[model samples]
Target chain A: MADKVLMKGNEAIAEAAILAGCRHYFGYPITPQTEIAAYMAKRMPKIGGTFLQAESEVAAINMVYGVAGAGYRVITSSSSPGISLKSEGLSYMAGSDLPAVVVNVQGGGPGLGGIQPSQSDYFQATKGGGHGDYKMIVLAPASVQEMADLTIEGFDLADKYRMTTMILADGTMGQMMEPVELKADAVKTYEKPWAVTGTKMARKHNIINSLSLVPEELEQLNFARYERYKQIEETEARWEEFMMEDAEYCIVAFGIAARVSKNAIVAARAKGIKVGLIRPITLWPFPKKVLCDAADKCKAFISVELSMGQMIEDVELATRCKKPVVLCNRAGGMIPTPEQVLAKIEEVAGGIN
Target chain B: MEPKRVSLFAGHYGSGKTNIAVNYAFLLKKMGKEVTVADLDIVNPYFRTKDSEKELSEAGIPLISSAFANSNVDLPALPQELYSLVERQDRYAVLDIGGDDRGALALGRYVPFILEENNYEMFFVVNFYRPLTTTAEEAMEVMHEIEDACKMRFTAIINNSNIGNDTTARDVLATFEETEKLSRLSGLPVRMTTVTAQVAEDMKDVENILPMVLQEKYFDINI
Candidate 1:
């Protein structure tokens, strides 16, 4: 009821970031996610915010690192190839324990693969694309509405955990338009005690650096980061379960794949198949327990993805390989249709029963 | 009767211009008129009329887009096929212009021919529900910017003010006064207010209703 308006997903994310009190935005223009920078460029000037179109993806991400260390909510957005360039900054942000929001409007890629929508960056995003044993919390959004909602949540989560929170979306989610509500004004939810705000004469200056020369000190940093990651793994995993109460088969998917799978699940149900969906909204602290628990009730698991077979690995691990896991996918920017998914569902049902 | 030989839809970003242009082309085709869709969207990298090329081709409506249109290739190469939109007066041409003034620059080349022909209806698509253009004055600023950029003034206003898929009959009706205010402010007639087929039945009493089927954002069926 708060004056919903139609918005492209990338634009929604940009506006939502501004509402969440993000005063600084640095990003290079990239396909699919171009609107985010354009919107920020147009609106930021009017609202006393900084919108810098960096010379390169590396430059933009480091700019984010600088602004985030200054204790301001900041964001940067890019596609796959651009994200690759930002990987070094991502690792540094993680090691420095800086809280920032990163938006990956994913495009097809192994190396500048295509401009079409793709989820092939699953391994790169969740498995730590940058060097070092660091992790960034990843959230995948299925709808344009989710694109905005999760961006606001991304900033909050980043602040709460003091880590990089990545909103991993594909081109479809970036380009698609849907009715979404944006906050005119958002309340900042957390205080940054460890922020590198210039210390007054009364307090000790906070240092924000990734490098610790001492090997044991660096080892301790890694240990402490992973301990926090463990706490996140236990408490922060998010997912959506559809028709899962009495499911015989479970379809694990996220983003656009999950949306397509919903229709397939409904169609399969009409054809007398008891199939359900487990859409992981959070990819890093993946819904592992749900998958492991559903394995006891479900006979088979199917991963419907926009990649060749990336998330299927996580599905196998999360479910503890309790049942046969199949990959139903189309790579290189192609999306699986409801019919194709329904046929695959039928095939799995036929094989199991 | 034939509405106009060449119809150009221009507006603020997210004003539902491309979707309306697509629907208008199909309407012309359904009216038993030969139609062509010219996509002049060079502003945004995605969400262009070229996405419906297959359906339009199947419907016998030729589509003219950039050479790199619909590809991951981000080249903003304007298509040479755009000349046909200005030359062919025997058939209907529906143009989906890119958003805002920067987008309207693509229209500058064909403006002289279109003005000389005088057989065109340049529509200023307005959606008061959009974030920036929520008021008549704000919407007018976009109108003037587009006109200045293209050197062709809009002939009428198309009220496409709806909140995407969640739009209801009341939402459409709520914008009636504002659309009317935009019309009075811009000195342009309110051509028609579009409502989706889902809520069109409830909006029967409304005047100048142009009921439309929303854009097929997803694939596997309708274009």
Candidate 2:
């Protein structure tokens, strides 16, 4: 077992990306997420990796596209507003089927909100921030350890699916510190037959681009991407259920909200409320089946989020609105306290009888 | 001997000085001393002594921070109450200085008063794993820079070399020779070494072991 040392979430993600064989990192400095770029800038050179501070988030993601196209592991990170700027580049990567890791150390939304921690980018991350029928596999990490673990997993899943994978972290998760046991440096064996590395008189030259001018061909490409998405939804849906045995009410959350909801569930259970929590690790896959199963046994549901009920829509769709789904949220960089979430749980559990 | 009236912690970024300061404050409180932590870290907003306001308050230790702390605003507005605590000689106070010479400038503001009234020990925390201060000479240079910025001399050094989650006992001991060299170069004593609680238990025979509670962030609720 590796020794445990305390590290902030942003630095942990950077270290994990390096340990996952990521050699190229391109990112612009943004509040709540700048530590990642700073860490990479210092460690990347020492480890013989490339760290480029691009002029803008747009240039950073496009640089990631260029690196990923050449068959090397690459990454880029930014906060919410910077992520908005990277959308066009994200769309190009998705269209080209380039495998890369993009980390969203999410802050408050819409416009330049604030530098405080926020999880308001749920829809933007899971629904493809860029304009297209493309999807990026979104992994929501609740702890600093997961910030490291899921980053490595994000890289693996991106290469496995030939798509972009995002570590959807908010300000709190990105800034907090925890003990993380990083994985050992593993050998890379994954094949990248579609990489646009120089041909060198090889069998054929490969081209990487997202522009398909032919209408029928574009339609066919969209269909194939959707098919892969369907497979991911079936096989890659990841979630964790806590104290769900004979739970009469369920609290659904992800990321930092899920961490707070766990405390709320414990408090509620101490008072014999019979409430449990369902934490979605992969937001895009949505973990609909587990939610539906809990919906059958639970009398009510409370979707705890750091936004204005963004994930609740998925909770509702997952359960088909079979049971009442209430929302307990604080948006625009405000975090809901455990007491606040417990109050909502008590309210829902009170009406259950 | 009586405990030092004031203990100040200064270090580079990622040196884990904030964690050491928090743990030491609790240690003083547990000894039945009136303890107060002044959060002079106006540079980095992410992790600082101010983030543990609730914990400190719960432990009956008052935390004095900047006015706009833990917010998006980067104002270096120090609370007036800190001046009173620094003036008081009855209580033990821990001043958590921020990273780099820029952060040490916050401590420079109280230099005249600190030098006049209080008997304080400023600890220069050294973490070899950090990029800038990787060697004895580099660490000594940073100490001199911090002293010049804060207008105060460091009385002791704390060896806190550890990689996050990848730190080992060997990693901590690897810096002992260099830290000793640093102590000799700066004419300061090697005060103590910080390690995680788990590591501290196994290496109890090691002298001057400061067992640090891993308080990296505010949120502790993990499911």
Give the distance in Å from residue A63's predicted Cα in candidate 1 to where it truly belongs. Answer: 0.9
Best by TM-score: 1
Q: Please, what are the lDDT tens digits per residue for candidate 1 over residues B25-136? A: 9999989989899899987666778778878898898998998877768776798878977887888999989989989998998999999999889999987777778889
Proportion of the native interface contacts kept in model 1: 0.58
Q: What TM-score does structure 1 among the candidates reach? A: 0.95
DockQ of each: 0.51, 0.30
- The deviation in Å at residue B177 for candidate 2 is 8.1
Summed backbone clashes in each candidate are 0, 1
* Lowest lDDT block of 10, candidate 2 chain A: A180-189
Task: For candidate 2, give the DockQ.
Answer: 0.30
Q: Which ten residues in a row have the lowest lDDT in candidate 1 chain B?
A: B214-223
